[model samples]
Target: MAVHHQASIVPTKAELLAAWVPRQPWAAGADTSSLTKLGSYRFDDPDGEVGMETHVLATADGQVLQVPLTYRGAPRAGAEESLVTTMTHTTLGDRWIYDALHDPVYAAVLASTIATGGHEADLFLSTPDGLVLQPASARVRGSGTAPSAPAAGWSGPRVTVAGTTSRIECDGALLTVLHVLETTTASAAADELVLTGTWLGQDRPVLLAVLR
Candidate 1:
């Protein structure tokens, strides 16, 4: 038998968020064009080749936002529009930065990490090639339909509630909520969560939630 191996590259906490925050649509003060990082942490990826980073940034106007960034070797095919921004890592040298949400492989890794404690429901989207589902560990209290198939060109996963629908996507270490019908009603609550891993240079716990 033969074994294959690959090199791993990880970025520092500052480097991770510095490359991440400005790209987010929800990022406040983004339009002003100046950014200052307040704090940051990392999410665990057992395979170090992929790096997940969470950052707290302060805008010139004093608004703060949490941004998560995932670093990958290459860009996902056909997702150039979803690509947020690209920058070089100081420690890693010349590798390119990629947004994880657009990449199915990284999404699977994130979903698997989240699905550890609870049972994974089968409400995922399917393609002729395979199925892509968001990993949910909470108990489904009521009956609801699964999400619709992923859309083409900058479309994200569909999550429905009552008669309304929303789109969910992950970017790097941060999860993005879009097309929300009602903002007040959309939220995430977890019983208990832990920060058991680290990415970039910060520590990350499993209970992290991105609420709209």
Candidate 2:
């Protein structure tokens, strides 16, 4: 489960994205000031130390993009290049944010989720009274079945961006995130496992990632 505290954050998520996203290679020339969050989903960290989430945003021009993020209490060593920004939380104090593509925790969870045909974690809102179940705006599912053996170990993800996609590889697992959502893409091979999602307006599943 993913628990969200009912607290305020300085430099709110939208504000942070506005300042940082426009500079990304895939989002270059994007007017992020008007970026609209279409939906989001969460993946749980087994250790429960870091928060993992992926947000889908639509540009002013109607280009859809996916951004995966990880939140930490302190800076991650050797991950300076992936650091997105920092923020102050009313209840959690200072927080560090990094692109999830560079976070090992995210890679491990994503790999496991895909290998096991898993769905996004259940969302829960932490309140003074207790925890309340919250509905997820976006829903995602992996296409693989249980694996017989564990994947080979890899240190972290090596990411490369092309025209409209980002390729991420780690621990012998290759993942391709479609930064720009397109419905006319070629069909996936029968053997390839993929991650697909649906949101409010989009009832048809949209290809989000492919695990090769």
Candidate 3:
């Protein structure tokens, strides 16, 4: 389970996105002015050194995009160019945020979630009343089980299909994430499609990634 805080984050997620997203090739024609969040999901790092989250966003004209992000205590080594920005969390101190593909924590959790047929973790709150369940954000489901999450120290083997870049670990199985997902143009070819969930007012099962 994940514990969320009511603390504020400096610069805010939207501010950072507005500055960095337009430059990405996949977001080339997005209408930033009217961008709306469709929903989001999260993954937990067993070691607890990082935070992993994927937000589904929608453009004014009806384009859906999947953006995965990783939060860390320090800047990712050798990945300066991918840094989205640095922010101070009211409760967690300063944090370094990066596009998920450049962070190993994201790679590991994503691979494991799909391989083990996992789902977005439940959320809870710690208070005087003890642990209380929080309202779920988005609902998601994963499939298959083989390309287990690599060991903690493993960085990643990032890949790109079509125009989307992904972080994957394909040993005995395949677990890959299409960083900038364009559902309208995604190819329906894969060993097994995994990870589907619900969005606000939408119940269609969207394929998050391809697993084999």
Name every residue pair that clashes in candidate 2.
Answer: none
lDDT tens digits, residue span 21-51, model 3 = 6677666656655657878888888997888
- Stretches of candidate 3 above 4 Å error? 126-130, 145-154, 159-161, 164-175, 179-190
Write model 1 residue lDDT over 1-212, tens digit each, in one string.
Answer: 11111223355445555555554544532432555564444444545565554444556565444444566656656767555555554444545455544555444443443434322223344445565653322221211122421122223433222211123443422333221112123234453211122223233222233322
Question: What lDDT is reached at residue 106 by model 2?
Answer: 81
Clashing pairs in 1: 41-202, 42-199, 42-202, 68-173, 69-173, 70-172, 194-205, 195-205
**Sliding window of 10 residues with minimal summed lDDT for model 1:** 137-146
Best-fitting candidate, measured by lDDT? 2
Q: Tell me, by TM-score, which candidate is best.
A: 2
Decreasing lDDT order of the candidates: 2, 3, 1
Better of 2 and 3 by lDDT: 2
